[model samples]
Target: MVHGGEEALMRQYAIGDEIGRGRFGTVRRCISNATGEALALKTTPKAPLRDPLDLALAEQEPKLHLLASSPPCSPHLVALHAAFDDADAVHLVVDLCAGGDLFTLLSARGGRLPEREAAGLAAQLASALAACHRRGVAHRDVKPDNLLFDAATGALKLADFGSAEWFGDGRRMSGLVGTPYYVAPEVVAGREYGEKVDVWSAGVVLYVMLSGTVPFYGATVPEIFEAVLRGNLRFPPRAFAGVSPEAKDLMRRMLCKDVSRRLSAEQVLRHPWIASCGSDAVAG
Candidate 1:
């Protein structure tokens, strides 16, 4: 995904090597020349003649990045230091998490994380989502790959806003957006959903974090979509032995198929499993 225009900005950071590739671009490990700080730079090609979905996805990313950075209570969102569009590509300099994404970590550990560690990460994610909801933003994508953990502080950040949107009083949108497995049933049904969709995604995320696999999965995308639509939520009893029952209860509340019955970010923060995370924790 690296293009020449991004090379200009990459020079400013003294990029040393390629880190990895994301859905729409590539990331590189680099050191900031000005501050002697290490970071990751993500680059995406400009959409002069890209597919409709790619163009829409690129257009959505930066808007949500701005919203995430604006929330003071938000957990450490990837900091966007600089950005610019070249004749052929778009460049973004973002905070680098050397510890990598949750997916990488989970893969290295055989797909399961220790209960306390997973709970801790989930608490931070819930807090971040609560902050976004307060500001009328919804992180339409909430899977492990989009969750990054900083090596220095062990702090978690929610990344990839390609499907996120502002839905507070002044701003609202209707469309089917988000990865199929993580998308809420209402969204799949073509209903006009609000931020509660994020709660559903987050619940799926929490379930995966605890159980080592998604609650709803099928051989095909449409089949998976059908499972989600049917509200076929099942958890492995043995996989959740040591985790708190309250944690499972909270996930159940958040993943309710009916958006009206689903718990709000603030309410989730107030739930027992979340409350135990901290006194200052904001509930959703």
Candidate 2:
């Protein structure tokens, strides 16, 4: 996983100030010495990972990233340029999205996005998820925190595959990974599930974008899990007043309690809401 150039990393890029932090690592700004271009470097300290499962998942990040970015890679995925490890930690070099993540964007915008804009973003998100699924991977944590932006390009890019896992050949995955707000019900129930779990999370994301609220409501984690298991959706008139029926329909299909009935990432792309993007919404 180190890719053999551990010492060459520091010689190639000048790591700068911290830009973000997550459960496993800290993302910092870095500059390529040769190109003078800026990028992101995620450093995961190898010290605190005591559990074997934790270590395995940590090592799996780069492998999953490599698999997901394989040829015909989606433009929506934050590109992983290189990965290596030094004495103290594993380092990931990736695209630098200077505009910040979608969570910050939503907070600044009163927690809601216009229909057309939300549609465009949802299309990109679905495209990224589909790309992962096609590569036999599952982005278990498909939340706003993982969606980033390029300030200059104004394009959203999905990042953070630390919770992602491979389920090649249709093998099922079972884990308690992912954030509470965006987690799938089957996962919450500890049941074996396929890649469609990402679809459920994506639906929650689209729901939040269109309505300013999480589909599953609760005052605490347990309460939220209860809401997720119940799976009742309510589109309050005030919140969804301007949202078109087709958009709501897509959400319903995506958030379906029956995993068998839930739309796949590809099916999501074919949904009318994504088609509203007016360009390549139905692209294969």
Best-fitting candidate, scored by TM-score: 2
Residue pairs in clash, model 2:
none
Across 190-221, the per-residue lDDT of candidate 2 in tens digits comes to 99999999999999999998888999999999
- Per residue, candidate 1 scores C-alpha lDDT tens digits across 173-212 of 6787888888899988887888888889888888887778
For model 1, where is the 10-residue window of minimal lDDT?
Answer: 275-284
Error of 1 at 208 (Å): 1.0
Local error of candidate 2 at residue 16 (angstroms): 0.8
Model 1 residue 102 distance off true place after TM-score fit, in angstroms: 1.1
Pairs of residues at least 3 apart in sequence or in different chains that clash in candidate 1: 264-284, 265-283, 265-284, 266-283, 266-284, 267-284, 269-283, 269-284
Give the runs in model 1 whose Cα sits over 4 Å from its true position. Answer: 1-11, 47-49, 71-73, 277-284
Q: Whole-model lDDT, candidate 1?
A: 0.75
